[model samples]
Target: MLVNTFLPLPEFITGNILWLAKKGFAITLFLIGTDLSLKVIKTVGIKSVLFGVILWAFISILSFIVITVF
Candidate 1:
């Protein structure tokens, strides 16, 4: 069940990257805005941000391993 929830992540990421590439500077600005927002949120006592970052790192590493292995 948990694995199923994340099954579409790679596809989602690929689509997002393609969309970003197509949009060029606009997408870059959006991503930068999101980063700034996240930083502000973290500064405002959002402790879960660290956990989210760790989770993202773990999932990214797992995805890399799966891709390399196959």
Candidate 2:
């Protein structure tokens, strides 16, 4: 954001570059999912995963309510 303060940047800077950078970022994030393996899932166990999902859902709902109200 700070760098973009220099906006309406010169013609040398184009949307194509930004588009390519965005795609690169998305591809990198997608590749990160490959690190999760079945062994890790088995190690953590389904019960633990269920508990985590429940906790996450609860927190998300609370946050949504709080943010919406205030």
Candidate 3:
């Protein structure tokens, strides 16, 4: 969304923002993934996990379709 909404700007500023955002995303994923355990997964249940994956897949496909069509 931010990428789609950003206005035209100087190349250096845009490059910095893109670099920082990528780093932030990597750190966030690392933090979230580090805490995973069998107990947590079992507590959440297989059904819930599978449902979330399916939902994510559907949204990803939809996004791809819309982006391509437009």
Candidate 4:
């Protein structure tokens, strides 16, 4: 939606947005990789792994709700 606000933006800023979009994918991938690595490090056994996964899912959902609401 924010991206849509910039329809017909001046060329320079438009280019910047395109560049940011490209870089954003890389950033997201890196973050996901780091998160998985941390989970691997913290895993103890099957029970702990399940709890960690559930906790991560809950946190992710909460974050999504907060971002969308705000």
Candidate 5:
């Protein structure tokens, strides 16, 4: 946003870059998903997964509270 205020990018260039970035991100996620397997999940164990879920929930709720309070 700041950069655009000083020297705005051409629409065509920004569009192309955004298109490329989206494609790259999709491909990266695809590769990562392909790498994940049941074996890996089994190794991580249910306990770890539950812990992660709880931690994520805690952080998300805390963030929401902070955002609303401020």
Candidate 6:
């Protein structure tokens, strides 16, 4: 942001930078997916999974309520 303020980029360069940022984001997600281990989840046990599901559901419901009410 500071660099952009000092030396403004042209429209085409800014567009290319956005494209590169998106590609980098996709590559990062793919790398993270490749490193993920399903076996670790299995070892963590069903109770932990159930607790996570409950927490997720609670958060989802709370956010929905907040959005609708606000």
Best candidate, TM-score: 3
Task: Order candidates by TM-score, high to low.
Answer: 3, 2, 5, 6, 1, 4
Every model's TM-score: 0.42, 0.49, 0.50, 0.40, 0.47, 0.45
Give me the runs in candidate 1 sitting further than 4 Å from their true place: 1-35, 38-44
RMSD of each: 14.8, 9.0, 10.5, 10.2, 9.5, 8.7
Q: What residue runs in model 3 are displaced by over 4 Å at the alpha carbon?
A: 1-35
Which pairs, if any, clash in model 2?
none
- Model 2 lDDT vs. the true structure? 0.74
Candidate 6 per-residue lDDT over residues 1-70, each given as its tens digit:
4566799888788888889999999867954766634676679887886797799799999999999999
Clashing residue pairs in candidate 1 (N, C-alpha, C atoms within 3 angstroms): none
Write model 5 residue lDDT over 1-70, tens digit each, in one string.
4566698899897788789989999867964866855677699897876797699799999999999999
lDDT of 6 at 44: 81
lDDT of each: 0.73, 0.74, 0.81, 0.76, 0.81, 0.80
Error of 5 at 30 (Å): 12
lDDT of 3 by residue, 1-70 (tens): 3664676677788888889989999867854876745687799898987797799799999999999999
- Please say which candidate is ahead in TM-score: 1 or 2: 2
Model 4 residue 29 CA deviation (Å) reads 10
- Model 3 earns a TM-score of 0.50
Q: How accurate is candidate 6 locally (lDDT)?
A: 0.80
What's the number of clashes in each of the models?
0, 0, 0, 0, 0, 0
Model 3 gets an lDDT of 0.81
Tens digits of per-residue lDDT, candidate 4, 1-70, equal 3765866667788788789988998867965876655556556566776786799899999999999999
lDDT, residue 2, model 1: 52
